[model samples]
Target: MNLVDQGAFRWHTLWLERANRSNYRKDGQILNKQAFVSLLTPPGRGAVATVVVGGQDCVACVAERFDAACGRRLDELVIDRIFFGRWRSREGPGEELVVCRRSDWVEIHGHGGRAAPASIIQDLVEDGCREMAWPDLLWQTSADPFAAEACIALTQARTQRTAAILMDQVRGALREQWEKVIRALESGDIPTASASMEELTQQSCIGLHLIQPYRVVLCGPPNVGKSTLINALLGYQRSIVYDQPGTTRDVLTTHTALEGWPIELSDTAGLRDQASGVEAEGVERSRQQREKADLVLLIYDASQSSPEVILTEGSGQQHLTIYNKMDQRSSGLDGEGIFTNALTGDGVGDLVKAIVETLVPLPPRAGQAVPFTHRQVKALKASQVQLFSDQPQTAAAILRAAARVGPVVSS
Candidate 1:
């Protein structure tokens, strides 16, 4: 579904504005005249839990079923007041958990567990609560459009680094970036417009990485210290380290962040002249990772052999060759490549810098005029249906079609 229609377009904007007025709050938009319910708590276990129920007349709907423990009527409860109460399962006569409600929109903060909160949710769902993901629910009731999108983006973040980046977006980082572009457009400054658009587009791309983690693999011969390098890069022991050849018979994948870019770092079994069955399978997986990686770090032992002895050609898109264990010998790389000792952390900063520079390009403008979503892509293509038409407005109509489905602020 389109991001706007999914309710992100409004929820985010209102949520942010409300947040500005008060630190603790949530906003939601109703979908199909039905109220949206979201479990603010994470999917798994936690100490405390938050459940947000919002929609038109959310206050009324929630007030009817929620009984305040302080002997206060739900209608008499002040806005933004935290009232302690036992959350009763709407499906039956049982306390769900100790709950609290907010003024503008109600927030139920209660004791957390797998059973209690889940039962509450199940009860609500059975009682006509449209059980939805937190992001989708917020999108439905959101008053601001961009904030809604930001919420979805933030919730989908795959890594802490990515989450940090998208958290910036949610706080109007992208909006400010787009405002600069809008200013340039208004001034009829073609050069500035083009430049700003280019810059913003780069930001948009980088911003997406925060939403979707990219795969990065370290590929090379076995015993080349690939695992050692991985341990060094990760700043902790992650992979098995043994001098025995072929010890790593399978690809070891780990999630790590570099310069706010989340990467799925993989250490594959070494590629060598002879291989056991397991090593062969690891080698095959290495090849697959190399093919899929956004960037590949090819490690070669400088003291042993050149990269040519291991991998013949460089990747077409993006890759780097590293000469590791430089402390053993200062002979330097026999061929052109980056040199580093994953053992002593020598040149590790450079390795990280190279990775960041290669992967995290700047983001695009907010509401990119061009199609970024599948729906917009399809709509733009359909506009071409009139390319061969006789109507004089065909080209203009097509352009309009592209624009309509393109970025536009919600009312």
Candidate 2:
């Protein structure tokens, strides 16, 4: 099914319309004053979780269940001020929470974990505040598609660098460029508009992979320390290590963050000829994985014969050759490959660096116009196509359409 038909994407559009209509109260407060609560952080075991409560009764709803250490009532608390307190639920003395007031909105910071956020949300729900997902809230708050996309991407950002880049988009990196393109097209400056579109298209290649991790595959013959090297890279024992050949009969994958970029490291069965039964199937699977992998680490034992044949087999794919068992006696057979001792963790860091570099040769600059989502990419492509056509007005319309966050709402 198309992305627009998906539940999340549909909600993105529906909630935006709802939020735009309910954004203001009778008192002219530019906030969603219908008592609603949404999680600002992912659901998991973490140091803290943030819940955002907004609407006319947001402060009152929270105050009913919250007791500040300073003994101040919710109405007595100053706006834009933070107060430390305990939340009281029917269950008993509630968890420790930090409350902050922002006009009609209130923020609750509490302990992280499934139980804590769940309990806190339940309390808010009982207080007449409806629970909403983070993504839906983000869509409602964003001004346009670029901003909405940036907000969604920021939530999934794994590293500081990625977050900074996405933050730039939220601050109008892509929106500014799109606006510029629109202005240029309006003024009959097709060259400028085309140039801006081309640049954004190029940046999209790396931008799309920012939130989504690049897939890297580890492949080599059995007993060559493929599993060992994988374990070293992951900083844990994720793959099984056996002295016997063909110990791993299937693909084993683990997700990890390297240098702030998300990556999926896959360990595949050793590749070799004339394997019987299951071992042969493993070897075939390894080859398949190499073909699909973003980057393949061709590992080999330095103490063994030349791996030229293995290298030649996987030559078409982007790969880095690694000579494992560097601690043992050298085979003196080397053309081009990083040497490493999986047992001692020697040269493992360099391997990771190489993989990251191979995947993303040059990182996108801060605040650069990048199209991360498929919808944005498709819109960009459509604009580019329209740019070459005889109809400049059509191109301008397409660019304007791409900048829209959701369907138009009539008053």
Which model scores highest in lDDT?
A: 2
Please give each candidate's TM-score.
0.73, 0.73
Given candidate 1, what's the lDDT at residue 205?
49
Q: Each model's C-alpha lDDT?
A: 0.61, 0.78
Candidate 1 global TM-score: 0.73
For candidate 1, lDDT tens digit of each residue in 212-250? 566878888777788999999899989999987687778
**202-278: candidate 2 lDDT, tens digit per residue:** 88877888788888999887899999999999999999999999999999999998888888889998888868799
Q: Model 1 segments beyond 4 Å from truth? A: 1-32, 70-72, 88-93, 96-104, 143-145, 155-164, 176-192, 273-276, 305-308, 312-314, 330-333, 361-411
- Model 1's lDDT to the true fold? 0.61
Badly placed stretches (over 4 Å) of model 2 are 1-34, 41-50, 56-78, 81-101, 108-120, 123-128, 232-237, 300-316, 323-350, 390-392, 407-411
The residue-level lDDT of candidate 2 at 405 comes to 55
lDDT of 2 at 10: 38
